[model samples]
Target: MNWIEIAGHTGALLSSITFIPQVYKVWKTKSVGDLSLYMMLIVFTSTLVWLAYGVALNLWPVILANGFICFLSILLLYFKFAFSRKVIVVAKVKESE
Candidate 1:
């Protein structure tokens, strides 16, 4: 591959991994207290747009990166809601006790 393509792939690789640590941490700790819902929504929306752009242009790097990012974003969103509910339920139980 040419330098330009290499750079694109390199960027794709980096972008794809950006959310991994955060996802892992949230998964491990079952905590979403610090994660902003708006930020996650914005990122998820942006990744979907980028994924569409990549597909329209047949750009493999963009497609791969954004697609993976989309998955990660979804996981984060799910985790945020799921964990938040758990926290709320626990709080209610504690209050009742």
Candidate 2:
């Protein structure tokens, strides 16, 4: 492959791998207290748009990278909701006491 293809693949790999730490932290802690749900939602939506654009253009790199990002973003959204509900329950219990 040419240098351009190598660079594109490298960039895609790096971006996708960067989500690993966040995923691990959330999974290990079972918490997403500090993460911004709004931001993630926006990003997830943007990634979906990018994936669609990639599909239209038939760009494999864009499609692959955004696809992986969409997956990770969904996980993050799940954790965000789960943790937020936990926090609310805790708060309500404390208030009741």
Candidate 3:
């Protein structure tokens, strides 16, 4: 493959794995309180568009990257509603000078 094609594939791989950490963290903590619902919705929508564009252009990289991202976004969205929001309150004690 050419350099440009290789770069595209590399980028695709990176993009596909980008959300794994966040997903894992949320799954482990069971916290979606800090995550924005709107952001996930926008990402899911945008990935859908990218997937359509990629399909139209027959670009495997775009298709794979956006497809994986789309799935991740959906998972996040589900987590947002399915998981309870956990708020941790920290109380600061005054120290004597």
Candidate lDDT scores, in order, read 0.94, 0.88, 0.85
lDDT string for model 3 (1-97, tens) is: 8999999778779879988999999888888989899999999999999999999999987888899999999889888887852232212222322
Candidate 1 similarity to native, TM-score: 0.88
RMSD of 1: 1.5
Candidate 2, residues 1-95, lDDT tens digits: the string is: 99999997898899877777897899899888788889889879989999999999999988988899999999889888987799889989999
Error of 1 at 10 (Å): 1.6
Alpha-carbon TM-score of each model against the true structure? 0.88, 0.85, 0.78
Off by over 4 Å in 2: none
Mark the regions of model 3 whose C-alpha exceeds 4 Å error after superposition.
1-5, 85-97
lDDT of 1: 0.94
What lDDT score is found at residue 76 in candidate 2? 88
- Least accurate stretch of 10 residues (summed lDDT) in model 2? 15-24
